[model samples]
Target: MKNTTTPPKIVALALLVFVGAVMLGYGVSRMSAQEPQGNPVTGGLLYDKWWTVTGADAPVGDHPLWATQSTNTRTGADTWRCKECHGWDYKGADGAYGSGSHFTGFPGILAIKGQPVADIVAALKGSTNPDHDFSAVLDGQALLDLAVFVSESLIDTAPLVNADKTATGDAARGQAFFAMCTACHGPQGNAIYFDSFEDPLVIGSLSSDNPWEFIHKARYGQPTFLAMPALYTLGLADSDVGDVLAYAQSLPGEPALSGGGLLYDKWWTVTGADAPTENHPLWATQSTNTRTGADTWRCKECHGWDYKGADGAYGSGSHFTGFPGILDATSKSSEELLAWLNGEANPDHDFSVVVDEMALDALVAFIQQEMFDISMYVNEDGTVAGDADAGRSLYAGTCARCHGADGKIYNFGSEDKPEYVGTLAVDNPWEVFHKVAVGQPGAPMPGALALGWTPQQIADVVAFAQTLPVE
Candidate 1:
């Protein structure tokens, strides 16, 4: 060991060199990994694009989401870049400029790089920006690439988003779209539900009911499974997106008038002045009570088109409600009838709230202008002039659903009064002729006019109604 051996010195020197090389290689790899993978080539080109509006350049500062940001400040192509609000890393004011005056608390799209192209496109097309959507600035492919980068490379936000759509999305644009929907669907979109069995789904119901589906559909289009039309097809501006969602979030989510009418047995309770009346004669005898159910809610229950109750059609079967027909009311003035509805002539039958002034006017209009005489066709013996056989064919095709073949399923009479179609046949024939010609109010009953029935065809129907049970 004491002998002079230079090998030890040489070995130590080689080891040092190897260690230094290894450290250098590791450092280079770390630096490379930290570099951003964003495609500036594609992103840069999309950044400066501009879309022309038909009208004067939208008022300078009127960006959809960023109300204060002026498009006029940016020259030529710079007016429409995503990087203006968001950073080069797609971090949006969350990265290098997060603390600057430009900071808008907006989230970065860098994390979404790996996401599906469709999602990215939707976000750009005002699907994501509640306040500031750039959809108008970018086309389909540009949006697709932007989304790809955000989904795959952006920082994970799973911890940030709550179960509801309140977090991680723009609420303003959502509100805007909701307003557009309110036109046909009512303010709440509950007027008509494509699905009847389930809870009536409105815009609020759809959003709160299923937030994921809401987000997915709101961004893209609604799933093919539903009847909802795609907002993209409507060419809505990007900025309007958040406005709609916000409005929808504020609306009532529960089903409207769900079971309110059943408890009162009054369609008038829900429909207000639009409720039907007991103008038909045979309305009393077909049901259990004259004041309830589908029958009492209808105007045709008491007065026949002939305005003759049991005297014409309700003289016999199930429709034999003994309420007096409206044949006599034809001579009554509009004021007199309005007073009657308000409980003047019939205090117990006050329908003031259910039948408002406008509705009363409609009823009076029907009575005064529309009522007619049918004595020539309808005999006291319940026989008609035209043809009963022909009438039967027409009834089966058109009038059978609600009226039934016998024309007597609902009764309109109270215990104190007993009236039916048979009673109308013998009493008043004019009211019967009127209803058959014009159709009953508030009921799905078809109008003879729309059905293209001839005067002779109507005469035949009256003949058959005369033969129906009225007792």
Candidate 2:
């Protein structure tokens, strides 16, 4: 008892050492178990617009944090999005948003990568600043997902991407990877125009000018464009995304052959071109594709889905018109085709006033270079002329992704008249063949021709598809 009382300072020092050892061990454990396996793609979308991702009601009024910053004129729910403040490149005011319509002086979270996950999580929860608190809206797991994405997925893209925003990966191998994307983006990635009317922004432009933004969209997908799938959810490696960027950047910057296929299919819907005040001058010529208004105006209606009017699918059916096939037009020059579209060759065929110069040129290019005869592969009765067994193999490689192994994942038609590859192959082989060759009109559906699938291979696929399900 006397010895214990004499060593009070020594006892205090020993206690401090034990406490330090325990704390050090805990810190080491935290390091070992840092980032979780949450999806960084989802995190990016959440950063873009959490309410849109979560399907939550828009937050009432402006963001509470808006009071602190007056530089950004945007108000209401937009002020609360993480990317609105932190920026898409994850550098806030330091990166692309340094002085755009999105400018906000907020510091980006990119510098916090490899930092303690707990600290990041704490910061998200407002441990560092009460003004930054997100716990009131985001639950624990949401906060954790954001934290993990920031800590582990925020890559140093400067090494992988150039100052011009082009990626530094292998583009050759990336071409094969791009097949998964062709269904929606088209072969050249020009299916959709994202920006304004005056300056259309296609995927190639987006990829070359802003690869970080491209990768972010390619990884997580555009929240606004739900049809575009996230490659990350499909288990693509990080390198695969980079490779895709490299390949996508290599695609042509301008729209090319078959670029106007959708407009040809349904110009009214595809171009959003205002309907003519008067019925088409040619509407009274022949009315087999007995549709009204905009439907009648689709080039596919009069010319045929097979692009061979009177000699193919629309030859003698309810969809028929007495119009000549476009196959012969393919041999014509661009000047000849332009004349045909501008009323010089055929007054009724005039589209100069309906579509702009670029659009007219695309249509002309499609007619001059992309048109082909597919009647040999498809029968009048919708029977395909290829080996069904070989088609089964083609289906495994391509169609299985969205159509499933048995081809019933998506119901393209209404529930009452359910559509599937089998049904289309059996009932409308010409339509299927056209879609396979040129991609679906108004959609980036896979074009067999672009992916190097021969007409025979497409026939084989149709043969296999016919064996699937009628209902």
Candidate 3:
């Protein structure tokens, strides 16, 4: 009779125990079902590993694409691998190796990252290219693994890159974070020379030109380099990468110059000046004066400070060229200046040749640095005389060889519209100083550096040029 109440409590306790066991079993089953099916990290590793095309065997026929595309026919097992054709960055035709002999114009596979695993597997299994079928090369599991990694891991870089080819991030913060990258890349990030050309893929140049590739490489680690750690593994945030890009973009791209040396050995090739006139005395002296593809050979022959021909120093002399002066050009705008170079004002003054892109840049820099007004010194009468005694000594050293002791050897001016070195010297000392310092681009006139002359020496030369005849 006392045990009847205890039996009811025991039954309730048994029921609770049974319910707890059932709940534990269901939880374990759910976890087992949700576990990762494939290893994507391993798949990324397999994707980078290359496969040989023929593998130590001689090719039977001329490679079908070789005659038109590439001369490289000695195919290895790894030669035709996807990674070999497309870069690790997955920008095949549009990216790093877009141009040159290796250009295949193949679209990048990065865009297919989020595609279904079945489609990616099909692409690998002879569905894309019969010649490129890799089904036999890799197992099904390996293919599935690769597809999983690509689908999950690949990133788009469009948002990070700017129109100016620079990274849109905080440069100052990036500078602080870029220290780890500077070891192999140098402090300036231009240390690692690649290819036979010894061309350094500098941080500044890469960041400026291709920030997306930079970020991908930075996060994934380079495929070939085992020592390099994946930044993703270190848990670096997107903002950190952006900061690095911004910092890299701030570095200098071009190397420092050796004080403006002649870019090309030939001065004529350096500056695209007008062609020399045949009747000019200077043209008769050398074969260079006659042969002309570009107009980079006649800078000094025209636009003499002493604009008068035969009336001043450059007229009847060895240096004389009966060419019109650029007396009116000082008032012209930049557009007009460019037009003059293109031969709009004068048919014989075309400058397209000899001046390549870099040369044009240098020329533009020169023009921007030198052009100025010189109307104050020149008089209406054309006779110029600020300081003849000071001018006489300067002329003897720098000008006497071309103009003669009297400054009347080459008459640069005619009777009607007279111009002479003396007149220009008195009138436009500023123009004379500019020419003397820069050494008229295409002309043989010695640069002030070559002449070992200072600004004072150039000014002194201008003073002497002013004493020469204007008419």
Candidate 4:
């Protein structure tokens, strides 16, 4: 009893238990944190990209890091992103970025995972690495959030994804999970295009080539696209994210268009194309549609919105012009349609001098593949045969933004002789159907058909719109 000094092993064991208890207690405290924690997903997004998150322009020139190296060859916004220097792997050049277009001679920050969160925050603020200052671009909270993500949230992603960028998770589960993504990304991830006309990238393409980058962006909602929600913030676990990634990677890739449908709707807005300096040549041929300039240049103007030409919407109205519709011509061979477009069949109908072969082909493809007859949905009495209930909902989301809630927003005619959307839908539904399907010429109204709305859905909205204020 007098020589009762604790053994060295007992002391070590007690210390181990003490450390474990402290860590467990700390973990519980963080889990039960009463104050609002910053959005680490947004932090990750900021790490991958700061300007997009902040909705600011690229930091008005080079980032501080760009002066440090000249070999990487990136500039402006690319240099400002934390991952540009650190990396999507968080390993910077020391890992996946060690060799590639992204290779920067910067060291990876993965070693800082277990480092003190405060220390990480300080380093980002340039307290340690003088050249790595991010305070100019990010606020304190953003910095702390970024540090919290780097120190506590970043998981090792290599094992979760294969070299081919396929996720190791269950794709089936991801498919079900994809429903949440579709509200914005769309059913096929084609709702939004990510790049320019010549080089386009959609969500499918982005997820396929750079699974790591996709994972990073997916976890954090896109900075510029504020509507996109970060799944991580929605309580998804790492495996859950991997599942979504797996499904996204498996999806097909299709560029929305090089400018086909829009050109079909109205051609001048695109680059290298000049707006009509004079009324369209066809304008002199008819005076029913009183508008001039680009409006006259639109294909929908000559071919009624119904594509029925003098046979449909514009058949008897003041807007009528003695032009033929494209319905019959649609059955013509591509060569025949191309010939028609090139003025081989109709000299006055020629667009050959205005648009090049590629543009002309796109227009032809649109006419051949997309232009549909409206007679199926529009009864002769002008009553829409679509489900009005479904149409009401579509109207709220897509149409009500321009038209008022009661659908009386725009009076496409004079006050004494008004032409409300309801008037158009109820009295001239054939016009409504064509306009809705192809999009209104000269207006930025979306072509419901091109936007993936079903014919029935377009009918529904048109029917519902008929119930709006006609007076």
lDDT of each: 0.48, 0.72, 0.51, 0.72
Tens-digit lDDT track of model 3 for 132-216: 4666657666677667767777655545567556677788877655654542344565533222111334567766766765776
For all predicted structures, in order, the TM-scores are: 0.31, 0.76, 0.37, 0.73
**Residue 24, model 3: Cα distance from true site in angstroms:** 30
Q: lDDT, candidate 3, residue 64?
A: 32
Candidate 3 local lDDT, residue 270: 39
In angstroms, the error of model 2 at 270 is 2.7
In candidate 1, position 332 carries an lDDT of 90
lDDT of 1 by residue, 1-471 (tens): 121111344335334434544553465457558853333223333332223211224334434545454332444333344555665435665654365555555566666666676666566776765545555545554554355435542332233234454434455545435543432244454433333213346657765544433433443333222223334334344334344545555667643323221212233532433445443233333563335544554545554444566665655455566656776877998889778666777666565655455445556655665454566666655456677677666554445434556665545455566555434533554455554555433333334532445556766766666677775
What does each candidate score in C-alpha RMSD? 27.7, 15.0, 26.7, 13.7
TM-score order of candidates, best first? 2, 4, 3, 1
The backbone clash count of each candidate, in order, is: 98, 1, 34, 3
Worst 10 residues of 3 by lDDT: 256-265
Residue 439's C-alpha lDDT in candidate 4?
57
